[model samples]
Target: MLPYSEEHAQFRDTVRRFVEREVAPHHARWESEGAVDRDLWRKAGDAGLLLTNIPADYGGGDGDFLTSVIMIEEFMRGVFSGPGFRLHSDIVAPYILHLGTEEQKRSILPRMASGETIGAVAMTEPGAGSDLASIRTIARREGNELVVSGQKTFITNGGLADLIVVACKTDPAAGAKGVSLVLVEADRPGFSRGKNLEKIGMKAQDTSELFFDEVRVPASNLLGTEGKGFAHLMTELPRERLLVGIVAVSVMEAALCWTLDHVHERKAFGRPLIEFQNTRFVLAEVKTKVTVARTFLDDCVLRLMRGELDVATAAMAKWWLSDLECEVVDACLQMFGGYGYMREYPIARAYEDARVHRIYAGSNEIMKELVARSL
Candidate 1:
């Protein structure tokens, strides 16, 4: 096991305390409502839990990726159901901070760090999923401003987002080379939101379809250059995937630890379930997988900090650990027998929650494709 720095451990303690007091208690209510309350976002901001990577001048915590990881693990420990603040903070914010002009950052960063503004990256269109290069959203320069058209779907935090990082083709014929990212404010004219989508899992996150109908913004809002979005995305994709991988592994660790506690106390055949050879073996195997997953995840996390983790390795971490999450949760669910199937049970909720791991964050199949490229 890699030794966690004292600072990381201290950060974890802060996150654990915050999660216990502020997040875990309210999570059940949030899940039942199909969306978390907007107020909790401010609470997170006040707690200094959002956007850990941005500099302190921009209203961020000035913390590292590990800080975000600590918060994510604590969030998952509750029930793995919450808004996608971590995604926005760790993935989307970095995109802008690294690429956006000073004016762009000035307009958006403070509110985002305060949690008054939610953020979403609109990359996945109706026709585009993992093939982001194929996205049809276009931004045309008309005189002084850029007019954007097209739609995005399955966007996390879509309905509530104050600004969206829209991926569009500035030159349609340029294919991937033409892609550019633009910041579109949510309240702008011609910007409309679709239904808050209902999904099999992650009910608390507001997933929706967003439309851009001739939405015009100053060219200054263009993130980076006009034709560098693809490169920018390539640079960030690994860290994004790594964040998802971290969440997958952390949640599994929480699940395994919780399940063991339950099984050790829950009686079966007049003996504690842990005494059964089958339960023991199941837990043993699950623990082994989780340990292995953690090792890989931690390595990826460290590499990300050192700026050495690449896109292919990130994809591998995402798919493999998430696949392992499903397997471990499935076995843990079975150990509970009928109770496992009940929505009232954490194991049951976890089982359902684990399903989306294979689908979202570019699906496990796409992950394999990305990993294949490295070979």
Candidate 2:
């Protein structure tokens, strides 16, 4: 049976059209500028394409998790990798929805839904990568406010984020139990964003460095209970890793399609590249991997919707699918030969974009460690 319902199919069509019209056309410019246009967020919000999984009371579309999945899949298929909509809608918004106070949700989720607020999670510090327990950012409580001080690097959407969910240490001596999540508005004093860090892939997406030099927010900005940030992150990271898996499968499929088209028409030695046994064999292998990954990912998505997805399974999907994505994209790019090496080819960009999948959302090595713990 197909994983999506009729409603999901229609939503997918809508997202596909929006990506083609608003996203694909401007991607080159976004890449050149090192970030997508801020107006694109508003447009996506207006189109009911942002925060689809949030409730209608919060200015969201009242859609399910599948709606967000459709959006991610369509965006990847369209090769619109610049916008951080998945992070905003799927990853960051859920944090506020599931953990934030009533006031915080009322104030923040609506803005996020409306695209007036771009959301980012600040977790990886200059010294801390996947080790959330080692984060040194301090959130000192003072009367009614939290004074946050730390530096966060490799923050996605950092340049354009309006609200950032920051992970910091509320108690220095407690280690993992000391971690806390604080909501800091970008306009707050002592909060500064560094230049958009240029990356090898996903060039249009702004990854940046954020410095919080004694930045303060109301104590109400604390997400969930104090000293429970690690728990909250552990609960939420499965979904984040699943999101990466979704991207991996979608990108793999897109790369396969682009390569198929290229090989069918591009002649080599007076014969189409697809006619070669080597080309056919490589593509067949890629197709098999893509199909398997998609099936596993679809199962994971359904489990996620039912609130039954576990951490170990999510890690499996994340690592395996990302590894498959890199392998497939690299093989596909080889078919394009010299043209693939140039940025003008879609396969070239896909190749570059696929490399980072293995690194981010907790490295594949870390995913293996997570899975090994369950074993």
lDDT, each prediction:
0.85, 0.93
- TM-scores for the candidates: 0.96, 0.98
Q: Report the error of model 1 at residue 369, Å.
A: 1.8
Candidate 2 per-residue C-alpha lDDT over 1-375 given as tens digits, one digit per residue, 9 for 90 to 100: 336788888888899899889988899999999999999999999999999999999888898888977887888885678999999999999999999888889999999998999999999998999888999999999999999999999999999999999999999899999999999999999999998999999999999999999998999999999999999999999999999999999899999999999999999899999999999999999999999888899999989989999999999999999998988999999999999999878888888898889999999999999999999
> What is the clash count for each candidate, in the order shown?
0, 0
For model 2, the superposed segments whose C-alpha errors exceed 4 Å read none
Specify the poorest-scoring 10-residue window by lDDT in model 1.
78-87
